[model samples]
Target: MPSRRSFLFAASAAVAAPSLPIEAQHSSGSGREMKQLPPAIAALTDRRSEAVPIKLGEREHRVERARGLLVKNRLDALVICTGTSLTYFTGLRWGQSERFFAWVLPAKGNPFVVCPVFEEGRVRERMEAKAATLPQASVTRVYTWNEDDSPYALLAKALKEAGIANGRVGVEERTQFAFADGIAHASPTLTVVSGTPVTAGCRAVKSTAELALMRLANDNTLKVYEAAWKSLEPGMTNRHVTDLIGVGYERTGFPGDASCQVAEYSALPHGSLHPQVIQEGQIILLDDGCVVEGYQSDISRSFVLGKASDKQKKVFDIVHKAQSAALAAGKAGTPCHAVDDAARKVISDAGFGPDYKYFTHRLGHGIGMDEHEWPYLVRGNSLPLESGMTFSDEPGIYIVGEFGIRLEDDWVVTPDGGDMFTPQSPSLEQPFSRA
Candidate 1:
């Protein structure tokens, strides 16, 4: 049976694919008669150097932005317990395990880290490598705890030093509940609140630099998708198509963030457990992206193997119209959910479900350091679209036991309205054409 890749795995699967995923082994339909490309990336050469990511200055500015959010949210301090939030503010990359690894950022003073005593050197090395300043980034103070000791006590002590011992402390929302509970237990006098307002405030909006990276990432993903599409041949499994894209990304000098679904399995949005193979005239969906520096890209294009059927073209047109409507409605003043409403309107007018019955998901999601982030384009979210904000403009139509069509592009809100990082699909025949 084919397995559905979870979000984390789906987003970065291309980056870490040593080989085709387990889903590839289960086969379905036969492929079409077409020219075959090299199956392995070993024969291809990387095409370009990677672009630089969010720089030292940008990282520093992000911290200041986060501080402003802290004030607005009435948080005296914020506790970042690993993950993207830590990387976003401090430029430090670390994962959360059983051990306590956290950054305590006080609204009034310097930030401090509570780390393991045995792991100090490596952490310090990473801090030095990634820090915006000469000595450090926000991780200026380091407090250590031995395994025999309580790391939570050290973290609480840091908070006390920051004068937030008895005040409101914002906890990174993604932090494991058990870890948050442990911290609360250790710091009896502290009030813990959600840090999302602070985290999302700093992250949702894209910088010029981030947008450039995204532009490059999206452009390259389309190129990879086009290459994979052209290389399809009769008898090639879905795994074969996936490998072609993987090679295209490698040759393009970026870690791939993509995968493919063939035939009826294309009806499933993330993909289906049904082992489906490529065949002539079957709808094929290539959904993926690559990281340009720290920022990322997510673009999905669906097309046919042979000639597209009338139904295929109709569904594709509807979804494309929905995507275009959402893009056109995007502006600085539009509410996040308003975009979804706009897109949903197009699909509904075209005879789909009145609401989410056919569309199934939101219009799109905020896209930057993460594939799916804040300021989601869902119903009831009123976050105003901002000039620097970026999101995926993807709309899909799924029909049971048949096929699905989704055309995705990365887009950013402009001073006037919004613009795509790459053009939307021109047509199934010439999806990459500017013409």
Candidate 2:
């Protein structure tokens, strides 16, 4: 297999990468202008199609991991109702309805699903299709319970039939709480253990296939950000700019959820998206991305509305350098916290250590079926960066009520090092200089 860095370099080379043209252009809505591109950073939009496919192997790998956990935990079977975990293990994408919702992956027997007949077609199309493609035997034994019947009864019957009559049963915290509670109530002998952590641990590590899809998702998001940046102005409302960003994601043929917040200074790092108006000399922070093929991308960036000050330029440089170093340090066999400290050190050394109050969030998180997954890059996480795992590398420096600067990128850890999924935007030197 090609190293992550070499793969990215080869991918970049194959695109006949064009020299990014960096210039400054004034917005017609306001006299404010911004940089066209940063030097040395090529736009990833050129090769979004090159992203790897999320294959059947990745799905099977997760199911096998769950089975391993079940045997080790001494559980007869595990019940999953969480949307992501259910989808990850059994390929069931049906939503929780007023009726019962669940699926069972037994330690020794076949996997089973409990859903309403109303969602039969959707379950087949979205969930069953995935199961059919896997190497595992067709394990989804559907139990169609009526909307009026007790969903817990149907689930318990299925579990009992599968030889799980009297042992520890695992349940997802989010979706299975009610149904699992009902099942445990019906069968007092069965122990209901929290299965959320087991599920998270199984899916947190990325398979090569999952990493490929994430790379594509993030690549498409890069274009969306560019379009949003171009359409932005001091006069545009936060809603309007965010809407435009959504359009960009859709226009590029990669669609998911796109959300954002734009604030002057009051809305510093990690500020909530609210009703606000942009103004001159203000900063714009965006937290947005799109989901593609069930996998999602979550990214954040900050820009200046009109002209920025020398202080802002220096801060931006430091944040960028820090994120770059963190990305460089991220690789298989390295501790997760070390990656975070690599970025934190750059920010602290820039003389903002005292002012930097909120730079302590995890530097990154796992990306797959869900936007926020596990194996977080935070203090004492200690999870080693494993090969084929993809994660975000975001580092920021923020003063709650004053101002903030953040830079984010996604990377896949290889046996040797990491590869950036979304390359940073070309330099903003011209924008900062003119501002």
Candidate 3:
């Protein structure tokens, strides 16, 4: 049997592959041509046209905000390597390698970059393209080093020239240890610290444009799940359902995928590697989501293959109520842990928990460009909730020998309360509405 991770990777790759004609599409795992798609999948129409990419102005605003945050955090500059923060600030996406390529943004002056000599042209070309979209773009200085030279030394020199020789510099949270260590070694006078206060401070809150993209992503994922669920058959395996989800996303013109956990395997939070076959009265858990214009959606839905047992119905209702309780507790200014506490309490009171006896994971996680980000909704997190912060409001109950039920939807914190991007699932038999 294929490992769960490998299966998920294959499914994700299939979803990301370019769309082919319905007649030409094949199963990513089996290599068998998908000659006929389910009616629900076949009926899906392209929704990509509705998505709008993030504008250069928004990114400039983000950089300006980051600068303000850097001042507030008392950091003279922020060193951002290849990661989400890089793209978040500059709209440039570059992969990481052993060699260093970093963008250093100071709180007071223009930003500069240090990269391998061979990649300077490529990096500048991309930056130029991004700059063209701006109303009044300024040229960013580039500092290059050959393979034999230390990029960290070049970075240090750039900082020194920018009047930050001995000043405190913040390193973006995801920067590699070697890079950070090298910088520290190259310039012992400079103080290095976590840039999360600046990076997360700027990224935790969503703008109207970001929220719009996320809403579209969640909307698309929920629709794909509903359609895939409608196409389920008694004899189909979990792999078949996974394929359906990938194809559903393809038809909708977005790259997405999901993992299906059937029956007892659902008891595992991330599910088991053992192959699972669908049967009447068995529970099926589907998790994961898709990306739209750099934003992401994470959703999970659990339902029965056919008629649910009384016990299953009861568990589903308990989980559903817990989810709602968590959402209600997610008001602005409330501590992050409060939301988790509220949901855990409901499950515990329902006799399924006693503090993690049944509910396995945190209520939810922060969602945006990354599936999981800052300000997690979990126990002991004292971070206060803020408006425009988006998170997954998921609550679940898992029984080792039985089945599990999870209901997840993306929600954004508003001044008054919070709002879900997609409607809550109604029931195992009718998870999605007819209308």
The top-ranked prediction according to TM-score is 3
Greater-TM-score candidate between 2 and 3: 3
Q: Quick one: best lDDT, which candidate? A: 3
Q: Sum up the clashes in candidate 3.
A: 0
- lDDT, residue 359, model 2: 73
Ranking by lDDT: 3, 1, 2
- Per-candidate Cα lDDT values, in order, are 0.77, 0.66, 0.86
Runs in model 1 deviating more than 4 A are 1-50, 132-139
Q: Which portions of model 2 show Cα errors greater than 4 Å?
A: 1-57, 116-131, 134-139, 144-150, 257-267, 354-356, 425-435
lDDT of 3 by residue, 1-435 (tens): 133434665754455334332335555653333558888988888898999888878888888898899899899999999888888888888898999999889888889889999998998788888884432247578899999999888888999888888878899888889988987788878888999999899999999999999999999999999889888888776767777888788878887767888899888888765667789999999997988988889899999877999999999999999999988888999999999999999999999868989998999899898888997999999999999999999899999989999999999997676799999999998889744
Taking all chains together, each candidate's TM-score versus the true structure is: 0.89, 0.77, 0.93
Lowest lDDT 10-mer window, candidate 1? 25-34
